[model samples]
Target: MPTKELSPTELHLWNIVENNPEKIAKMSIVKLSQYAHVSTATIVRTMQKMGYGGYTSYRESLKIRNNSNSTFNVLNEADDKIRSVITKNEIEMNNTLHNLSYSTIEDSISMTKQAKIVYIFARGLSESIAEEIMVKLQLTGKYCEFHSDPNIIRTIASKIKKDALAIFITLNGETDELVAAAQKLSKNDIPVLTFTTNKAGKILAFSTLSFIGYKSKTNYFPEYEVRSRLPLQIMTRIFCDAYSVRANFYKSN
Candidate 1:
């Protein structure tokens, strides 16, 4: 991850409090929410994420351990900031994400115009997104390959036609493997497009086009991916629309 992803709230919240063990021991969901910028419910969820039942208990555990924490608090807070800044209030974050998602279709259409063979290399959660695109683009009758197997992703990436197009999806964007894969694709002169959560991340330097996704809504009370998933879904629909338009043009031939 980029050094800038660190948040001061995480710094203070995790900082060693040798002065008053009670503050760490007695921290509340409300106080953590105030600092973390996520909902109070999310703070509890954050505690749960750290293996505690809830926020108050999580803080108490910190008291037990003498406070040696790491960077995940910063990561979660950054997720909060992304949601706050990028998502629209009272709007179906899904709709907002769909609006942004069309750009992916636009990107696909542009690539299809040039690449006789298009290779999609993604893994993990991105594999789902890639497969959806592969099916949709196949309707155009253009040759498209979606590979999530790490070996094939790298192997096919190395062997792609020099003029082909490569699209990568890695939300974190700073992941070492994806970065290396992108570097390989770039060397072969294959245009690389990427979708990621952090636009300022290292992947942007290599990607000709990129999109950042953020969560729209959250109800930590019940547990969900409503905020982040909405934006991703939006991208999916948008890409479908753009590709549909391009597919029509191809049909004219």
Candidate 2:
């Protein structure tokens, strides 16, 4: 879909479809347009951007998938649970890829190449992804610092040079400390790049460039606070690989 390239009206229509996928599966193009308060042509264009030939095919596919899922629900419980998890992870990865903007990625790579030093910040599970980025960028011969501590992040944000780049990785992107640090960095005219699963995250306002990944809200374990980090990992892997290629090319040139 590359939703970042969508116009405001298209993005709005996408949000409506995304939030109410099951309901939308039953909707006609005219009905959806009326519901979304946009023209039918807008709805058709939005579906086309999602790689559908038209609204009818998109709705049909969703209906078929829903029917298949209903039929699959009668399977053995344990095997079904495992298969469902795999399916959800696959969908998340696919959605993340579709939402990614190549231009934004290239700009981020260029910014990293120009920076004297890169400061990476993350917490919890995201710290692992940040660490991977730190190590990979360092291997490309760039000076990098990785921090997971909130206090250290704020301190570094205050003291970082103007030419330095700050990359923040967070699942929700509402971390108070990270937002504060991003605000501080922006105040000092430092470029901030953010990777998050939340498109409307507060961190985006302070970011010079932001990449949004997909994370399913399905709670497989309602008893615990576990969620998939696969989307973030996928985004991190792509960015690191692209950065490495660009860095090597520039070095050789």
Candidate 3:
């Protein structure tokens, strides 16, 4: 969680939880609130703010965490480039699975399914990814529009209906044009969905729902180039596939 996302009271409560996560699983909300010197309402509000439905859901999650017993081991060195690629992708996929917020993904899928129109905005290499998303959704009989041009994006975003959905794909989430377009959508009361690197950025602040891919390190040389986009690509595929399955189930029923 980003510091910018937390209120002063929430931050205080979060600090306590961070320092005493194991104890939190055993403590009731009332006890936790009392210990933090805040009201139960504060605790409930904090849970909602952090994307949980309520105290019970959040508490149950904490309890589940306390019961988890997982271990990790480093991958062995590969004998060839092909083997190395597979090994690295496996590691990155695990990282993404560990870091992903399924609640957020579900929320995004719900919004997309309900939206009157879906607009996908991206630039450069991400524009191709956006087009792929558009095609995937369209193939499933979902209406989608793709926009990579800044001027066109701003124009459409300003005019889109509140019931429409805006999906922005940016690796860093700091592109000036995309951020400006997101702001426009925000002002119009349209929901903005974003896929970006795990680093905290302004775009996430503008998003109604957000998904984070594993962060990639900076490339320094040809041999060390961070060329793989498996994390984001995997997230995109999962979302599209999930939505398609849901759509089919609804139609079948």
lDDT score of model 2?
0.78
Q: Which residue segments of model 1 deviate by more than 4 Å?
A: 1-108, 216-227, 249-253
Q: Which ten residues in a row have the lowest lDDT in candidate 3?
A: 71-80
lDDT of 1 at 71: 19
- For model 1 the TM-score comes to 0.53
Report the C-alpha lDDT of model 1 over 1-253, residue by residue, as the tens digit: 1213334543343343324457645544434445445433233323333445444445545655875552122111122233543344324443335334332334345555555776776767667888887787777776788877777666776777655667776756776767777878766545676766665778766664555665333444456322244454455556556667756733444
Ranking of all predicted structures according to lDDT, beginning with the best and ending with the worst: 2, 3, 1
Candidate 2's C-alpha runs over 4 A off are 1-83, 249-253
What does the lDDT read for residue 113 in candidate 2? 77
Cα lDDT of model 3 by residue, 217-253, tens digit: 5333458434556777877888887788767733544
Q: What is the lDDT of residue 20 in candidate 1?
A: 46
Task: Tell me the alpha-carbon RMSD of every candidate.
Answer: 19.1, 13.6, 8.9
The backbone clash count of each candidate, in order, is: 8, 0, 0
Top lDDT prediction, candidate number:
2
Off-target runs (Cα >4 Å) in candidate 3 are 1-86, 218-227, 249-253
